[model samples]
Target: MSLLETLAGKGLRREPPTRDEALALLATSDDDLLDVVAAAGRVRRHWFGRRVKLNYLVNLKSGLCPEDCTYCSQRLGSKADILTYTWLKPGEAADAAAAGMAAGAKRVCLVASGRGPTDRDVRRVADTIAAIKERGDVEICACLGLLRDGQGERLRDAGAHAYNHNLNTSEAQYGDICTTHDFGDRADTVRRSRDAGLSPCSGLIAGMGETDGDLVDVAFALRELDVDSVPVNFLIPFEGTPLAGQWALTPQRCLRILAMVRFVCPDVEVRLSGGREIHLRSLQPLALHIVNSIFLGDYLTSEGQAGQADLDMIADAGFEVEGADVPTLPEHRREAAPARDAAPLADAVPVPDAAPVSGARADLVAVRRRGAGTELPPNA
Candidate 1:
């Protein structure tokens, strides 16, 4: 049998490929790589077809993190000039969800920084989620740091459908990136969220100086955990962050990583998360072949491709955005577009009763939530 067929046949049950084997695939010529990617694309098509799931992030809080995670601009003792603020009022978060819905996003993520949420934080987020749900349709995914024992239940009750706590990297390489907490802590949160009945959305960051073995380990770990959604982020080096100016990743390398993850975890929602523009750039269109979803609009502490541009890209690639198949603006808000340069940065204080405060960093810090209601940090 052909190598591609053999690889596809083994599927997720296939033994993890060795570093040399992965490198051999990575080293394939562009023509050969495309052929491999084409095979992988079939797997993607079989499950997701031409429909693209677009997610928008609402950084409900920004900056003021206590953890010393090396890669974050919001970590303690860092000098990155980002905005910081507290949680948004419930009304505002809901309005943001409406904006996301108007922008054609299938899901709107509510992300916060710091060490989980206190009971108070949970209630506040829960209320916001309830309000968002009242409006209808858009899926709500909450990222409130490390989840507490019952906080996931509270969120589920509040109408949150998913929880996002990225593993960031493989277990073996996690320590090198952040010393404040162990990889197990992140895993536990996912488990807790699952037990609470919320869909567990977890993922990793590539190009953080990890080995192919490390990548394989992370891919298998996600598969073992049965993650409902996997967001594969490429590290976007920020000034004052530990990994700032570390390494540059090529588009082909990024595609290979995406293809590898798709081959390993065939059924999961392999999303193209942060760093798609800078690393993938012109090649972003091709990534959709292997990845079933992507983040629409902006990301935490970073600008992303404009919503209209994303719509154009989807059409150009022969794929359809979830809500708008023909590429035209929605009927109700044809003239209304998300402000081109209006990404908001707000400080995210932990909701009380979330997770224990590890010496590292709080789950989230200074980040931005697009839509309505802007909560600026003390200095901002």
Candidate 2:
């Protein structure tokens, strides 16, 4: 069988790809990139069909992180001027989640940035999760840095459905990104979350100056760890961070990475997380064919396409939003487009829940602006 055929067979069986098989997907020639994506799409369809899960991020706490993850704008000793605040109050967190739910998101990710949450911090997030649960039927995922002993059970009891901790790169490449924590520390957390009966949502960040071999290693590792969700984040290379000048990604390359993750993980939820807009550009809709989930609006510290546009994107791609009917765009509204050469989606809060409207929204103007690259930080 061809590599793609063999990989698809393994994916159909929900079998993990061997390291060699995973590496071959990454080594695919640029000329054959689309073929790889199409093969991966077959596997994606087998698992998720045409349904796309929309997730919304609630930045419960921002900045003030002590770890020096070089690609992050919020790391210690960095000078990025993103928002900095203590944890949001429980009601505020619920309100943010409500905004996402209004935009058709099925899951609310509550994220905080730090080494790990204290016992008290875990309770606070649990309270926020409880409040959000009280309001809607949304699944709650917590992205506090690391979970100490018993913290996962506390979160699960508080109504959290999952916990997110990303293995942002391979074991060989971990030190190049963050020295404050080791890769084994991340693996341990995933294990703890699973033991506590919480779904493990872990993923990786690409284009951090790592070799293709490193990418394959991480994909297979995620399979070995058996995480429930895998978020594939492209590096934003935010200015003022250590990796600011590393512009090594192209749209086609990003697609190849997503396809590789899909073939390796098979039935797991592969999310087109964080750097989708900036990195994927016009090909954003095509990514939906290979990955089953995307954040609904602005990321924790960065911005994204308007929620309406995201909804439209899902509809335009002929994919239905999971758990809700996709809203149809009126003919006149279809003619309206974001301002040409508009600003990047940053700093602006996502649209709050509002009444249904006809045509493109008059307030939905896109202008080109500069600052932090748009991103969705892993729930931590």
Candidate 3:
């Protein structure tokens, strides 16, 4: 069988791809890219159909973070000329959320920039969650960095449906990106989220100078964790961060990364998050076949594509926006019936050889001048 055929078959069966198979998907030639996507698209359809879940971000706090994650525009000591502000009041955050929901976003992610949330910060987010709930029905996901002993439960009690803390990259290379925290800390938080009855939303970022092996390692790790949502982010390479001008991803590379994640975590919600606009560029419509979810507009400190443009892209790509009433997970992973015959852990496999990556467009990264924490009207 062809590599794509083999991987697609494994994905449909919910079998974890061997490390070699995952790396091979990343090394496939650009000429074979569409076939790879078509194969993974089959798995995406089996689980998610043609529905694209729209998620919106409301940056409750921006900049002044203590953790120095190398790729983040908001990381401490970074000169990235992005917005920096204190937490948004509950009413202000509610207003921001209403706009995204009006544009058909089903989930509102409340994010803050910090090492982690303090007890008071968690309470503040609870109030913001309450205010956003008052506006209309929307799934609430809090992305405050790291969780203390009981913070996840507190967020859940306040009506949070999910919590996001990205593994960002492989454990082997985790320290290279940030040292204030470690990979074990991230895994612990995901465990905390799941134990607290909040849907675990963890994922990774690409184009941060990681090798193909690193990407595969993280994808398989997330699979083992069984996180409900896997957000695949491309590094934005903002002009001021330590990774400034680091452009390691091309459109094809981005697609391949998304395809590899799909094959590794076939049944989960694979979301095309940050940096899609710059790296994926015009090929984003193609990615709809791979990822079932996307951020609607504006990342924490950078501008994304226009919100209306996102809707148009979904339509043009022949996918429907997943409604708020629709469940994001397959029936087996849903909260109502959580039990399942857990698949046996795949055997340890050696990392495959690294794949060749191509050039990136340095001109594409744009700092956020509007949206939350700004005077200009926020994009939906």
Best by lDDT: 3
Off by over 4 Å in 1: 11-24, 27-31, 323-380
Residue-wise C-alpha lDDT for candidate 1, range 4-97, written one tens digit per residue = 6655654434344544555555556566767777867887776667878778787787878887777777788767667778888787777666
Per-candidate local distance difference test: 0.72, 0.78, 0.82
- What 10-residue stretch in candidate 2 is worst by lDDT? 359-368
Q: How many clashes show up per model?
A: 32, 8, 0
lDDT of 3 at 244: 73
- The root-mean-square deviation over C-alpha atoms between each candidate and the true structure, in angstroms, is 11.7, 10.3, 10.0
Give the poorly placed runs of model 2, Cα more than 4 Å off: 324-380
TM-score for each candidate, following the candidate numbering? 0.82, 0.86, 0.89
Angstrom error at residue 247, model 1: 2.8
Candidate 2, 1-380: lDDT as tens digits:
29999988888887877888888787778788777878888998887788888888888888889999998877998777576778888987777677677666777899998999999899899789778866666677899988898888888877777799999999999998999999999999998888887778899999899999999989888888888889999888787898876768888889989998998888888999987888888889989999999987677677667777788888889987766332112223223322222122121123244313222222211211234743533221
Per-residue lDDT, model 3, residue 260, is 96
- TM-score pick, better of 2 and 3: 3
Error (Å) of candidate 1 at residue 37 is 1.8
TM-score of 1: 0.82
